[model samples]
Target: MLKISEDKRDTIIAKLKQDIDAANAYYEETIEPAVMERYAIFHADKDYYRKMFPRLSKRCEITSTDVQDTIESTMPVLMKTFFGSTDVVTIQGADGTDEDSDRAEKMQELINYELQQNKFFMKFYRWAKDALITNLGIIKVDWDREYKEVQKTITMDAEAYAQYRPQAEAMGIKVNAAETNPAGGINVTYTAQELAKNRPRVMNLMASEFRFSLDATRLEDADFVAHRKIVSIDYLRMQGESGMYQNVEEVAQKAVAPHYTTLDTQNNEYIDEQPNRTDTGRQKVELYECYVNLNMSDDPDGRLTPMIVTVSNGVILRCEENTYERNPFFVLSPRVEPHHIWPETGFTDLIAQVQHSKTAIIRQMIYNIAQGNDSKMAIDTAALVDINDVLNNAQFIRVKGNVSEALQPLPAAQLQSWTFNMLEYLDTVKENRTGITKYNQGLDSNSLNKTATGISIITQQSNQRLELIARIFAETGLTELFRFLIKLNQLFINEELVIRLTNGPMKIDPSDLDGSFDLIVNAGMGAGAKQTNLQNLQMVRELSTQLAEVGLSGPQQWYNLAKRIIEEVGFKNVDDFLIDPSQMAAQMPQQGEQETAGEDSKTTIRSAITDAPWQVQMQFWQKLGFDVTPQMFTEQVAQKVLSSAADAQAKADASRGDVMHDRLQQANLARPRGGGRMAGTTSNAGAQAGGSTGALEPASQYNGTMAGNAAGSTTAGVSSY
Candidate 1:
């Protein structure tokens, strides 16, 4: 433990108290007065001071009295009060503390420093206010309420007090001696922490109106700047090159020939032109050329200049120079009218003219035929010539008169062969026509009829025997005849020859070559038969086995065959064919011996009818008879046998007192009634007969008796089993 003597402790405590008191007094007397001065200045300027003093004195409620109290409340107010305002200040203390004397001396020093600081702040505030008023038009003394609040926040501390003590003493103010205290003396530190925690209101009061002065000026002289002028080459060269030309003769020689002139040079020369008219035709032309030059710059070699040249007739022509002595230049040749090398004529017009001329009379003949006219005679005459020459240059066949000789008329024989060959090709066209129409138009009964009729007509026409006017006219004879019909159809029926011929319907049956008939007969019934009848006819011919055979042959054989068959077959009435008892009896065998034979045959038949019911066989048998009902004869007999046998067994079992057997037999005979139970009464007699009360014996006993009866029947009689 550390201890101090009572005297030393007392001295230390007294020194600390004195120092605190001095610090407080300094702030009250010095720092507070200086801040008040600034506050007064800030309050005077309203507009210019608002940014710094955001709040006015009225809003902040700051006053000189409030400021003084604030300073007195804070111990460090002394340091901020005096030294805070001046550039520098010093505080003086007594060497030794003799209680009253030391305290009085220190207090005097602090008071002196405080007074000096007050004077310093007053001077600073006055100077600042004057500066702002002079330069920025601001009256610092009239600042608003916020400025007054700022004035209240000024504070000071021990170091500041000590620093200003010497000046304070010189100003007749007291300072305090430095000392330490056993209990911590009044704190004189102004740390940001203490300011933030304990003096926020005061600090905010000052901050709200805090301001500083700024000075600015613009430089008069700047380094980067310029001014100048540009000269023109045209202006410099306006005096002409003569003054600058040393070798005039050489330049003149060079100018004697044409030289190329660029657009810019030409424009310049054009701009420098003068107008004049007192000149020869050549001179006048030169003036015109000069006029052109005045509107354009001269070419480098004067290539665009038009010169006047006189001809023998005194005609003047403008020509561009072609010399290249000075510099190469482009010269355009004189314009001339173009002459036609050949005339134009249309092929159609030429052909028309040829058709009208007598020398080409054949052309007209061909044109008439091509237009679907009846030109058979002319075609016949042309067809007699060489085929290549006739066809290639054929008068009756050429569509256009201008057709070349290579397509002349074909010879009659060759033409006949070609026509025949074309018929073969027409077959393909016929096939294609059917296929195309079938695909596009769809197959229907009507279309099929039309097709068959068309095919028949075409086939007949193709195979027809024609009477030729002459052998040499065969080509024209056939073609002209066919063409006439085609043209007639085209004119009257409005159908094309190619379509009428090639698009003819498909042949229904190629084998029936002689079945040609008019399609319009019987309202087109013949057309329907063109397909169906031909098909039937074909079947009769090709499939003879399938037909009724007849030995007749050649033309009309079918008709004869039909007649003979009809005559041989006598007519019979329906009743004559009907089954009678006599016929039925004849169909059956005689009784007795016949019956034996029938029985033998029945055995074989029965074997064949195995697994078939008697009723089924009897139905078939009665079908052979005219008046028998299988139901009355067969089904009734079967029902009677079944009923009688069932009844007899029932009576026998009852009489035997075999109640179990009786019940069993009843069960066997009884059909199912309802609810899945057999329709038979339980025999109470069985219980009475000393049998098991609730049960019946098996059917084996009855089965044995029936078997025994069946064996006895076989031995007793020979009847149909």
Candidate 2:
């Protein structure tokens, strides 16, 4: 820690104050006015008009609600696109090692758990809405330890109290009461402010309270970033007492009044404009938590150090070097300009002019219709018998002069049909600007072209713009937020964080999460894209099934396919539908073993049935729900067994023949030699008496040549006579 003297602190504070002034000046002059304009339009519900209407006419004022319509209708879609699943973001392992993969997974789980605990959904909702409306949204992420007060009432006897007294004192328990009962039991009522929790926090900061350097194009490149807020004097005192701040008592004594900016006034519908005269401790002071690089003149090393400075009423409440490696603020924008950090125009901003044009056209149309429905009459007061009756619109009007000449109906202008055409044209313009149409909002009843192809085209085109916005948000702020979270866990977390996941309870140790990882945000593209993805996944499943039939795929592959399909269908917990291959692997047999076991079991049952007595076999078949006699069953089984045995014998004989042929070829004894003659021969007379064969004769010549060959003898071709 770099210590600063009083003079050096004053000099640094002055320089920061100058920077703050310049930043605020630019914000008020440029960004704030535009924000105020959009804010009014988005929340516009009252009647508004640029000029007064004529007397005794319909002065009905109308304000177009297209701004609100565009924002509210688009918000739900963006929310669903980002938060449709539990894995809002996923982690990819660095270096592709198994340990890194495991670490990445555990880190992701821990980050997601922290997000859920901090109510990240609401924070994201607010942040996205701000960006859509104001062209910029910011969130602050930090690590902090917070203490929440807890109250408990314990009933203990005298002996138990003696045992618990020291523990209660250590816990800083404030006793409210101690009552003794007749049953020799005492009830102890005390409040223990000891629920100290340490975790990462995500806070959605209002645009009005955030400021940054004006000359920078991005937050990372900015020289200073500050969150201007109002805190009570007592809050500062408490922080000081906790040793988190210094010189806070002096600042609290001179606490300044809260200064509400123009944007703040617009955001707050009903704000009190009074200063606190009494209760100085409860008075609110303007506090600017500025993160900047300060180079003090104290002269150890003149280089700049990243510092977190807390300023209120020209006094430094706290100043220290920033321990978190990076800045804590993350900004999100749907659209960006080439040369500036602030977005060019938000969704509402682009359609603001269209809203104004439609409001004007609709207002005129209403006015013209009113005049046409109730036209004014030209009456002569001098010839009128009762002017009061004519003025009161009485059914009967008495005129002394010629009725036709005395009372004449004035022609009021009828509304032009082109005005309605102009209104419709403006609606089209609004749709084109914001990519929000009736089709996207589920109001496609009036569409002229209702063909499936046309509808799909429209849906895809509309969703492309939304998908782009989602991609921007996911890639920019969301990724940075999770990265910051990982860094926080690495820096502050020491013990294991036990989180109950969808599969089961998992313990993530800090040491297990030490690595570099890549983040992937799981943002749904759109309905059209999702449908396409689902089709693709289904096709993959078909291919996988085919491969499995041919023994190319296994249980693990099937499990992965099934898990992916479930996730694509918007279900996060695949365990509810399918068992994991890893867990099932422990209890299941190999594929070949399973098949062999199945066949053996069947054969065993059949043999047991065959060997049983007649009565037992009959009873067994009866118990199996087969209505058959023992003889019939036995005959069927005998035939099956015979067929099986014959097939096995034929296969064995064929295999042996192949092996013998190969051996004969290798030995060059397949063909007859020496003129194809046998070694032993005799004359015709000797041959007639008996059979004097040179070699083994054929089976048809009354010799057992085939049986000898079947017995693996080599006397088939040259047999003994």
Best by TM-score: 2
> What tens-digit string does per-residue lDDT give for candidate 2 at 634-716?
44344335445545655665677987545544443333322233222222232323232122133354245435444442222
Using lDDT, give the best candidate's number: 2
List runs of model 2 lying over 4 Å from the truth: 1-3, 45-58, 86-88, 147-195, 269-272, 296-301, 446-449, 522-524, 549-552, 586-721
Q: Lowest-lDDT window of 10 residues in candidate 1?
A: 286-295
Query: Least accurate stretch of 10 residues (summed lDDT) in model 2?
Result: 712-721
How close to the true structure is residue 99 of candidate 2, measured as C-alpha lDDT? 88
CA lDDT scores, all candidates in order: 0.29, 0.74
